[model samples]
Target chain A: MNGDLSALPGIVALTLGVGAVATAAMLAPAVALGFCLARGNFRGKALVQALVAVPMVLPPVAVGFALLILLGRNGPLAFVWSALDIDLVFSWWAAVIAAAVVGFPLLTRACEQAFGEVDVRFEQVARSLGLGPLRSFFAVTLPLARRGVLYGSLLAFTRALGEFGATALVAGIIPGRTETLALGIYSRVQLGDESGALALCAASFAIALIAMLVAEGWLRRSRP
Target chain B: MSQRTSRIRCHIDRPGFSLDVDVGWDERVAVVFGPSGSGKSTLFEIVLGLERCAGAHIRIGGSTFDDEAAGLYLPTECRDLGWVPQSPTLFPHLSVSENLDFGRARAADRDPAARKRAIEVLEIGDLLGRSIDQLSGGEAQRVAIARALASGPSALLLDEPLAALDLPLRARVLPYLMRVRDQLDLPILYITHDPDEAQLIGDIIVVLDAGRIVASGAPRDVLWSRAVLPLSEALGLENVFEGGIRREHGSPTFVSNAGLQLVLPVSLDGDTRVRIGLRAEDVVLAADRPGKISARNVLESRVIACDDRDGDVYVSLDAGEKLVAKVTAAAAAQLALAPGSTVYAIVKAQALRRLG
Candidate 1:
């Protein structure tokens, strides 16, 4: 027990930043995929849905290993990374990639459920009012499904903040860099810093609580 | 009138149902009248280009929306026709004004003027600030109509706009629809199962049954035509008489716009102008004027046509206004009824129901 607590702020900031970045990065794709799943009727739809849920159901470590193989040297697309002169392993971006992969299923599932709850008639009415397909979705369908999407985003953000196995595998727990709250807690407990681990736990709990409270307030306020 | 024409020739095949209709009319207001499963809404969907039917030809107000032969099909948004679907589909997330603006924003021309006219004609001005859920059934329908009209469409397509409302609410909303019909010069394609609504709102009634156009012509003539008697009788075809009430000899006398007078069973307190409904079955036909009959009203009417089908005879008559009487085939034969036969239409005052 060194009784040193100076690394707390850096770890908290890195954790929050990683969660925010990863959630932001996945927002558009998740919404698009979710809407497609909710409304589309096509061949191979079941296979697509199953593939989307694979990340959520599979072990996070396995996902990290797969991502590691894809982004690591001596793997496919290795020349692209080498050409770009970028090393992705054990970096902040690697942690974001890991968090995004793990949190994607939660966000997408939420979006699909939310969009499914919206009546297609609203979109049809919007289209009949001279709005194109894209405009109708934004003006009618998306707003109607906002609560579910927002709630799903908060779920993914919290999941990203707590991402441990995937982040640890792809992005090693480097001090003041790739280390987040969950990784910090694991590393602190392993190093016999019980107080540090407890502090990180409290921070995680506080962040999860505040994010949910804000989302609930927003959802209630915007309820039709 | 510019001799506007609306035409729809489409064949839609669905599981356990098929809609094969070819109907066209020169009237500005063409109504698709039918029973519940008669594909009235489906026909509307085809006209709006919402339902894609290959080789379907839909032309409204001289504008072609779908002509599959020419390989041209305008999407629903590009149809440039105001469509009020069967249900009131006001956007729940928006206020009434926002919903109106949603349509007005995309209007090609007369943006503000169209919006203003829609708001005024539908009488939804006071309801503009309210949310959709806060509105009553009638108010929501009015707002829905206004929203459609605000788009400045070349024509309007209404799918049973008053079907969702109760009787009183329908009455309250129908005048707004009538005002829309009278005030706006746009061609209207209205749909309904109610014969009265068909008679009142539609200049040309296209009777549909089993996903087919049974008859299409002038409202009264087509509705009472031999071709439409079976379907119209099943729909409970009602003679809709529009008139005013005045106290004659201490009793309220109902005088229709067409100069037919009748005694009322119940005296209405207020509102002199009213519409009454008389069912075909409620009208009893007598070969001779009955002396000392308990029935309140008796009028001599010339038979236009007698359709004997399914063990009943439907006598189409001209008793000042067009009226129908359903009598047994035996009674029809006993009276030797046929076209140009002089008969008496005995209508009990109690049989008349105040529609509005």
Candidate 2:
């Protein structure tokens, strides 16, 4: 029973790694989509926004099921995965893909609100100063909107840390492979290891609390 | 036309308002003069290529920025014109020095000499280290202008550069504007609603009213022209005189450069050189000098021209310096006002507003 507790560190590390990798994977796409929603005026924008927000509002298990079918062995993309000789389902990467899908909407929405707060005239002035569109975005718009973007990323990362239903359905409870803190807590309770579940719960709470405190401190220090 | 002349033709149609103007000038400094909502800023935006007008043609300093007929239109960045907007739109995230560097980095060719001159001319060398929010309004405006100049633009587009400042700040910033105009040797398109600023700074003036060109010529003539009298009256056009003050019989008197001595309501102090502004409606025209009148500085003058429009007469007077008087048509008829008619101009001491 004491030896089973040795897997605690591996669970915490895998959880942190999944959250970090998921947040990093979605950062660029989220910023681009957020900027487009904030500034672009075109037809069918509402449809695009609604589609992007589906994973956030839908049931997490349902999203995991959808992803399973899309990347499963018998799925339409099975040949592509087989051609690459990569097993996506029930793997560590499957956990990352699930976490990224759920966190994308949160990060993208935050980015949209952040970019909206920036005045368009600043970009116009930048262009007048001889900066092209991309350069102006980096030099003026992105810097001004960095706070909101960072806060959004923090929200998505924290959300990813606690993701259980999707990760459980897709990655399964394979210790040191795909079992994160959330899945480990659930698996320990099923195994009747009450002390192990409580210990994992405490570790999850500590990491989340520390992450939030550090993010708040960093954000406050950056205020101009 | 000279090789460096600027020409612009724009026609914008909108609901309840339309701006249609076709004007050109050979002078290096052209002032777009008009009241608010008269499309003065719109004209500048068109020149800056911020607003695209179909079939419009713009040529400044022998460069064709936009020509619909030629299928050529340069973007705002490629226009190569320095634009100082109404507000000092300095980047809040950057310090003054960074803002200037941002502009300088994009120049076609790096010219350290021009960048140094812009900083020295605006006297913003001390402000380079400060962030935008730490600076006052006047300091921010100077930094904004310097940032535009640091880009090494081909021409300059200044939209009411002094309008955002208060009277004292305007006075402080005017010299820097003059320095940019005099020292830079660049073609400039300036927008201003103030007649005094127009007269003092512009080599030529374009008067716009209700989105149309009412008159375009020399500043004094364009504002005081017969066609622009009604619009100018709405703008509160004032007759400005530059002179020195002297003590006469325990009261201060203003001796204008053209040699007319007039009593002032305010006491003179510190600097003797002063600029004063009088509204056209403030000057009273009488056939004979009144006796024992409360008004001071009654001077004999001859009418240079008489413009009768919209039930009012705009009488141009040459009383050592140019002055305009506005009176009803009935009053002009009673006084028999006409060109070359000698009249006594009655100016009250309190009517003279001190303008620096």
- Best-matching candidate per DockQ: 1
Tens digit of per-residue lDDT, candidate 2, span B1-356: 32446898899999987899888888999999998999998888888787899879898877789988879999888887888888898999899999998877656474556678889999999999999999999999999899888988888889999888998888668767877987889999899998887877799999888899988999988888777766775676788776788987877899888887789985433257666788888999999989999998898999999888888888999898888888999999999998999999999998987665
lDDT by candidate, in order shown: 0.87, 0.87
- What is the fnat of candidate 2? 0.48
Docking class of 1: medium
Best by lDDT: 1
User: Candidate 2: lDDT of A95?
Assistant: 95
DockQ of every model listed? 0.73, 0.59
- lDDT, candidate 1, A103-124, per-residue tens: 9999999999999999887888
Clashing pairs in 1: none
lDDT of 1: 0.87
